[model samples]
Target: MFTGLVEDRGTVQLLEKNGSAIDLTLEISELITNDAHIGDSVAINGCCLTVVEINSGTLKFQAGAETLEKTNLGLLSQGDQVNIERPLAADGRLGGHFVQGHVDGVGSIKSIDRDGEWITMWFEVPEALSLQMVPKGSVTVDGISLTIVECQPATFSIALIPHTLEVTTLGQKQIGSVVNIETDILGKYVQKLIPLKLDGFNERQ
Candidate 1:
């Protein structure tokens, strides 16, 4: 699992397609690359990927067909920047909410509004996913954990501090740019259990 806290940004060095899968190589930050080893799980743009090789200050990962179909990683090109984060360690602090690095669905930037030093960005999300969100709830966007400022029927907004804009890819995003989104895991669990609880209550009544 990941905390949705991006440690550093990496440059895409190469993307090679092999049948239905693809091998991704990134020139990652030295801080992460140096400590990384084979089989370590790293979240790339909120998609959990396994380290398959480390070569000449670069890290390689394999993305299967399912990942390519579900995420924006498939749209990556050479020199493109990607958010990178190592999995949360057993004793690590939960600075951010629990992010499984499982992209629920892809969303697109619909609007960008700025106020002083803060930026409020709205994303057009699938209606089904939007229904699971709440105001002030947690959501992972392009691997950066953020709080939902407002929730709507088919869209949501989040406020980004200046530091967040400077450190993550969201800073470079523009209207119509696609992003990987992971809704709150806790919310999903609650939504799933409510129906079962209602059934049990009805039986008791």
Candidate 2:
């Protein structure tokens, strides 16, 4: 599990393709000589990837076909910047919300506006994934946890402070760029629980 708070930005060093799957190698900015080990899961642009290779400030992971079909990682090119976050440790500070590092669906940047010290970004959510959102609720976009400032039927807006702009990738995101989206964790559970509760009530009736 992750908090959707990006620790740093990494560059795509190399990509070893094998049909639909590929070995993704990312070079971290910090010098991580030996801390990173094999089989460690790291959130890359909100997608949880296991570390297949870890060197000094560089790591490798296998991106399977499922990830390619569902995310924008498949569209990435060499030298592209990617958001990177290490897995949440047992004693780590949970600064952001409970982001599973699971990308629900991909969304496109619809609009971008700058206002004083803040910025507003709107994303057009895909039809299938729009059902699980709520106004002022939690959503993870490209692994950056954000509050749904305004939720429309098919689109949503989020407000970012100046610090968020400097700390994460959302600030540099372009208008037409695609982003990974994960809806609220609690909201999904509520949907499942409500149906079962209503069914039990009907049976009692």
- Give candidate 1's TM-score: 0.97
lDDT tens string, model 1, 1-205?
9998889999999999989999999998789999999999999999999999998779999999999888999999999999999999999999999999999889999999999988999999999899889999999999999999999998999999999999999999999999999999999999999999999999999
Off by over 4 Å in 1: none
Error of 1 at 139 (Å): 0.2
**Candidate 2 per-residue C-alpha lDDT over 58-172 given as tens digits, one digit per residue, 9 for 90 to 100:** 9998999999888888988898888888888999998889999878889999999999989999999976566688878889999898888888777999999998888777878
> Residue 106, candidate 2: how far off, in angstroms?
0.4
Model 2 gets an lDDT of 0.86
Clashes within 3 Å, all models in order: 0, 0
TM-score of each: 0.97, 0.94
**Local error of candidate 2 at 87, Å?**
1.2
Per-candidate Cα lDDT values, in order, are 0.94, 0.86
lDDT of 1: 0.94
